[model samples]
Target: MALSVVMPLDISGESAKYPALFEKMGVDFTARRCTTPEEVVVLARDADAIITEGSQCPIPREVIENLNRCRIIAGTQIGYDTFDILAAAERGILVTNVPGYCVEEVSDHAMALILACARQVVALNEAAKRGEWGFGPHSSHIREVIRARMDALGGKTLGILGFGAIGRSLAPKARAFRMRVLASDPFVDAPVGQEAGVEMVDWPTLLRESDFISIHAALTPETRHVFDENAFASLKPTCCLVNT
Candidate 1:
């Protein structure tokens, strides 16, 4: 019998990459369109292995009960808090994910967001297009933009919400800018956080102290919507939040 493989990404031989990869691996596989969390269970119920980019669909202990043939689940991207690994391990299901799969692209995107925020890219571009230069006699139009920053990244604290691969990846870059990094990850040991030159702190302490906070956390039941109203309200008013 062929090994049954189910991928949660919508696939087509014409443009999709997986078909060719499976053919190369000499494995039997199927891909389905699963955009919603609800659609996951109905389609993944019988899958021997699930290769997915999205993981919101909870793979609870019950799903393990239902999946006898399933041996492994491979997440296409970095985070897989959607998969209950502890439960899966109890049931002997191997879970894997591609780490920092698109490192350059992701870092580039984050840096771009930070720079755009610093350079007033949106406002200046819009003004330039309309033939509007500095309205004030001496760089006055940019005064409002100046208010947004009031301070640059240097000498500012950058609190990284998670000390996983992505957070560690950004640390040196943030440090290079002469910014202090404070990291909070329940799973991270004090030694590791210290090795990164980031002081280990509680979530509330990190949020309150940071001038620029970047979220690099994996979404878990505990972490989903973790940055809700109360969390945001706790941040310093001058702080900026960046999500990736």
Candidate 2:
């Protein structure tokens, strides 16, 4: 019997990206878009493996309990919060995700957001469009207000929560701007941050000392709502936060 691989999401358009590889491995592949848990359970009943987009649809415990032969559940994205890993593991199903796939792109995006906030790019652009050029007397007050809110990246501290691939990638970029980088990740050792030219600090220290905080942690029981009202209160009043 041929090995069966089923996609419970609509990836027909992306089939060409992997069909030849699956064929080379002598595996049977099927792509079907499933909108509901019942649809996923029915379509994946006999699948040896299930490929999922993960973000659009969730593979709940109920769906996992009903799968007859699925040995593995693979997600296309780094975060797999949409899937019930505990339930899948109880059923002897392996769960996997693609990490570091868009590390550079995401890191760059984080930096862009940080710069935009630091420079007050959006507000300044809008002010310009409103004919409030800084040369005018009234515009001078606007300039002062904007300038009061903006700060240079140099000599500032950047805190990264979760020193994973994207966070590591972002550290060097922040350093390039002459900012001090602090990282907090209980799962990672201190040397990892030291090697990346970042200081490994506790969550509270990172929150209180940082001029900006970037969140790159995965969503899990321990991490979910880690940044709550209390967390926000710990931040410097001038601190900017960018979530990716």
Best by TM-score: 2
Candidate lDDT scores, in order, read: 0.75, 0.90
lDDT tens digits by residue: candidate 2, 23-124: 899998887788999998888888899988788778999999998888999988899999999999999999999996799999999999999999998888
Candidate 2 CA-lDDT value: 0.90
Clash list (residue pairs), candidate 2: none
What lDDT score is found at residue 120 in candidate 2?
Answer: 92
Q: Which whole-number lDDT from 0 to 100 does residue 181 have in model 1?
A: 90
TM-score of each predicted structure versus truth: 0.77, 0.89
Off by over 4 Å in 2: 12-16, 19-26, 137-141
- Top-lDDT structure, candidate number: 2
Q: Give a tens-digit lDDT track for model 1, residues 91-126.
A: 788989888777656655665666566566777777
